[model samples]
Target: MGSGTIVEVSDLFQNQPARLSFQRRPVTEMAKIVDIVMQHALSHPNVAFSLTNSGRIVFDVPSVSEYDDRLFDVLGTQASGLIPLSVPSEDENAPGDERWTGWISSPDITRGKGDEVHLFINQRPIASQPFQGAIRRGYKTRLMQGRHPIAILSLKIPPHEVDVNVHPTKRDVRLKHSWRVLERLERAIAHTLHSVATAPDSNASSLGIESIKETKTETETETYKKPSWAITATQQLTLSGDSARSLEPEKKRPISSSPAIQKTIFGGKPIAPALSSDERDIHRYSGIESERPDSEKPLSEIINELPEMEPLAQLADSYILVQSGEELLIVDQHALHERIRYERLKEDQNQWKPQSRISSISIELNPKEMSQLQAVSSTIKSFGFDFDIDSQSMIIHSAPAILTTSSIEDFMRDLLQDLSEDNQRALSMEKIKDEMAFMRACRGAVKANDKLSIAEMRRLLEDMRCIPNPWACVHGRPTAMRLTIHSLDHHFGRHG
Candidate 1:
């Protein structure tokens, strides 16, 4: 058991071969060697304990519980870096089952030969094709095509759900929900890639984009539409004011003698007795019809209704300048439009019940793709699509009202792509729904560079105010940002 001791041992084939084997040594010798190795490993608390031949011990002690820290310590000077991740649980009820873990170096936490990594799920380390594939996919962005990053992930899930009996060494575990776990892991890794690769930190220069100020104006030539009831009400109110004044008695009249004379004089206007009930009914009907169109109006009318602001010239075809008292307000046309569209879409979604319309054409998809679609059917339904899968093809019975005129094929394709992306992660249904809604809103909204009329700009502002998150777009990009006059003055060195 200790040093370079050679002893004869029987082989399974019963062949005589010279092999360095541990003979049935005295209990004292074995115990002494075990004590020495354990003491050595215990001394280096940061090192992983491993016993080698000749009674030697090799080990590494991890710095912290995080995958990256542990990996850095284990690899020492040879280690490249770490990709830390925390994958949230897919189940709503078992929210605590989220995995706070990552992958680690496998002797070769690098790109060359003997390069390998270890994956631990639920604290019980294990290696599987899908699990490893998930890690590879997640690091696909950071590392070169063939080169892989040395990573250590410590996955945390409900211990009871992971069966540790799958391997003799207990380095691998059989997850009860393999796909769900793998998807979560993959998403965590992808997110890590995005954060590392896409982040625009403070060091980057600004885009030099300025805010736009919306200047609302009313066209004098455009006649404002007045409903019949409003017209009638205005006329009646004016007439009532004149009649009430005229009918007031010049002085207090004696009630005894002049009652009949007062009544004749005080009576306002004689009712038009010649007009029959039928004629009155006809008049009412015409008034109702005339008012209906003006009452049930589109948003454009509402925008035009606002008081016109003084004309302010456009700057660089983006910002609209408006003077509010001594200060100038500039708005981003794209952000304003995005905010408006988001609010309108959200309001429409909440206020109206989803209405389905049957499609004449049936959409076809493969089984795996269909399964992915079915998984996110509720999310799809929220975005105003009700899909039914039949023998030959999938039928889109109804779509969102906004998408009514859009191509059904394009809608299906986009929906499928979204579903596919979501399926790659163990995301909550709520998160999935939000993502789908945001995607739809972004797709449907007016893009930047689209010219807007002054009235339209005003309407956009009104709509933006109505939205819940007006400061940012649906995807979390800032919709509009403000720069105070003081800051502008300081930039020009006037404040100094």
Candidate 2:
């Protein structure tokens, strides 16, 4: 009506109360509407986009000549941490094999949620499983399980090369000469990951952490500098034998914020905007939380079931080494905790819930995430989270007692994305419950580089003796490995 284009919608469900009853919360609806605007904003970075809800300026990002600048406008300081990517075409004859230009965050700059990887085609937002899978394939072994990197990549090709009409929503499309495109894209991404690392560019099988790691005993006190990428040392480690060990935190982490690529901040999500749906079906469900029939073993009995693995030392502050008979058992602390949490959750439905406590923090939401949160609100609440929503924004009034303010935002976003995928399919209640437990355990588990006492390590092993699948975590990664004396003797040429 004035100098610029103005689009407005008045009453949405004026007379359709029945239909309105089936709709999501007002805030969720607003998020979905705004999400459409944001997608168009990312896709058409040259076009100035502004949004208003109830006269409040939700965002007013100006047009920018460089798409990367637009990224800074929409993604805030998070854009600066990303590595610029330029993928060359593999072959001239192949369609959609044209070079890709975009930015992707490194493995350490990851989110608890998998929804941030945004992909596009020909300057239009489009989703393709093969493309998303290729991106993940590039990040393989580099990232911790359940953590996702933020990526915004786009492909350029003739419009005919991609069939956008395949999906009703048009977000997903069918591509021609896809295998060739995927192969090159995967290799390009993998090569980029390798090239960007500080160490020798190799697809290392065992990614030995180069960062400093420390373990403190109860009698010792020490001070250390904290890295920006380090996880909080919040867990209370188990004591060895009778006495307990306290895992005190530094309380303050000198988290270095990335410099802003541009002055304009995008909705304060320093990361990216909005979450889209999944690229594939639930990966390796394998009835992760199914009930296993086992004899009722007492806690002491379970602890004693396995051969005594006497606590030796915490290796590299990541692995725990123990002595059992003439063998050495190397246990991955993070993986062991993940499996322990998963088993505890699956053993009792009540274990899925953490103690609830009041916490007041408001979070900005992208429309897709808002919709997903609304879809799985019940399941989310079951895990001890409570939120109040309105068209203006959503405020968290309560959360699980185990989560700190620093982690609540991340954990919530992660669960929203994971549960949203589960909701897309017609899964059984058991399957859905199990999936939620799987994410909960993964989120709550201790991470690598976390310091654990010898006692704590022994307690974890003892707990593992009772778990049904103690060999691997819920993600199916090996938790512990053994090096028997027989094998060691053979290597040393010590024949009997």
Candidate 3:
């Protein structure tokens, strides 16, 4: 019996053991191994898999043929760190079976680390080195150096043309025509990166650095002037003679080129030259003055010289209303205040050293807000808003001269909002500056519905008349309009 048992044991060991090798191992040992394999397989569903232990089949999972929950689980895990982005795929004119869909990571979020990325073509995962390299190249300069983007790029190509059995794992795919796909991928990735990294935030005010500089230079130039010898010569010539023929030769000389002749003709003082009868008629129609007081004279001289406008009816709180011939004019009191403020601002902008004033005030902003403020610091400087920024808050050193009397908090809030908004719209700096100027004018102008005293109304009209475009407000709205006596007569049927 022992001999027979020994022979059986030998036979079993050689072919099939009575105590099987599988039975000798702990159940948990096999379970752990199976779990590891299953997890890996679940993580990459697109890749087909089959598992066996000691020639006995264990688990077999089919390849994923579409992007479903399984695919999303795998991709979403891989792209957790990236900024989510989406784009349209169908070109309106393209043929039916040639559509594609895909997503690219944002450059701002990528910041140069490129490992967390995946690609799919026709629902199959691919590890195409050449294609991934192209994506990296697109974001080369837009992101910080040495950082690679995280992306999950997918493309849809005609099924029959692409070979899914490129490798044993089935993760690799081969495209029969990949050049077009490659081009489109490059363009889309490049475009998305450019858009996010460089796009400005909306809410910042628009102001032109160059324009503010130019305006400052002009204001400075206007502050000081050489005596107007031409004015004196013109005044003397008018007093000396009324002969139309004599005035013709003087008028023929170019006003700027004949300074010497102007000095001799008008007594070596600067003022507008005398006008002939015909010239006076032309001047009256065109609104060009035939004469102006010497530049050295007080501004009141010009004001007094102006034709007397009707008296101001009443002073209602702050507004001023005046009558000009047949037209009634309404002006904003605040706008007038703003104009005065603007003039002072201009003067300060022109000076060699801007006037320094102090206020014990501070403004606080969150970290994100501070970053945006820092980004637009140079622009704010151009507007004469000198300040410092820290993580906790922004400190105001000085403000524009005109804004001194106003609430700093309110002004800063408005300015920041305006800048951010304009920046988002991508408006040019010049347009933003013009908008600011308009705001200042609106804030300073006189408000409607306010009564004004006769003196105040007369004063407002006189000042309005001196402005280059007296008929319109700074925003181009008509400040006053005329109704001719003839028109009134026609309206009454008297002309008929």
For candidate 2, write residues 1-496 as lDDT tens digits.
2377766766867877677777665665565666667777888887888877678666567888988888877766567768887453333333443556678877655665555777788988776455767777666545544556788887776777888898798887887867656665665666566566522111211111101111113433211211212325784432122233355654445633554422122123423222221101121121123222122222344643567678799876668898988988888777777677666656664543454545477766654565566666776666566788764345887764434455465556656655555235444446645655665565445665567766577677777777677777775666777777876666556886
- What tens-digit string does per-residue lDDT give for candidate 3 at 385-492? 677875446787776544433344534544554444322454454454444454444333334333445555555655544444454444333344344455546545
Question: CA lDDT of 77 in candidate 2?
Answer: 58
Each model's number of backbone clashes? 24, 2, 48
What RMSD, rounded to one decimal, does every model reach?
29.6, 17.3, 28.0
How high is each candidate's TM-score? 0.34, 0.54, 0.33
How close to the true structure is residue 46 of candidate 2, measured as C-alpha lDDT?
75
TM-score of the candidate numbered 2?
Answer: 0.54
Candidate 1 lDDT at 259 equals 59
User: How well does candidate 3 match the true structure in TM-score terms?
Assistant: 0.33
Position 148, candidate 2: lDDT: 67
The candidates, ranked best first by lDDT, are: 2, 3, 1
Which candidate do you rate higher for lDDT, 1 or 2? 2
Compute the lDDT for candidate 2.
0.59
Output the worst ten-in-a-row residue range by lDDT, candidate 3: 207-216
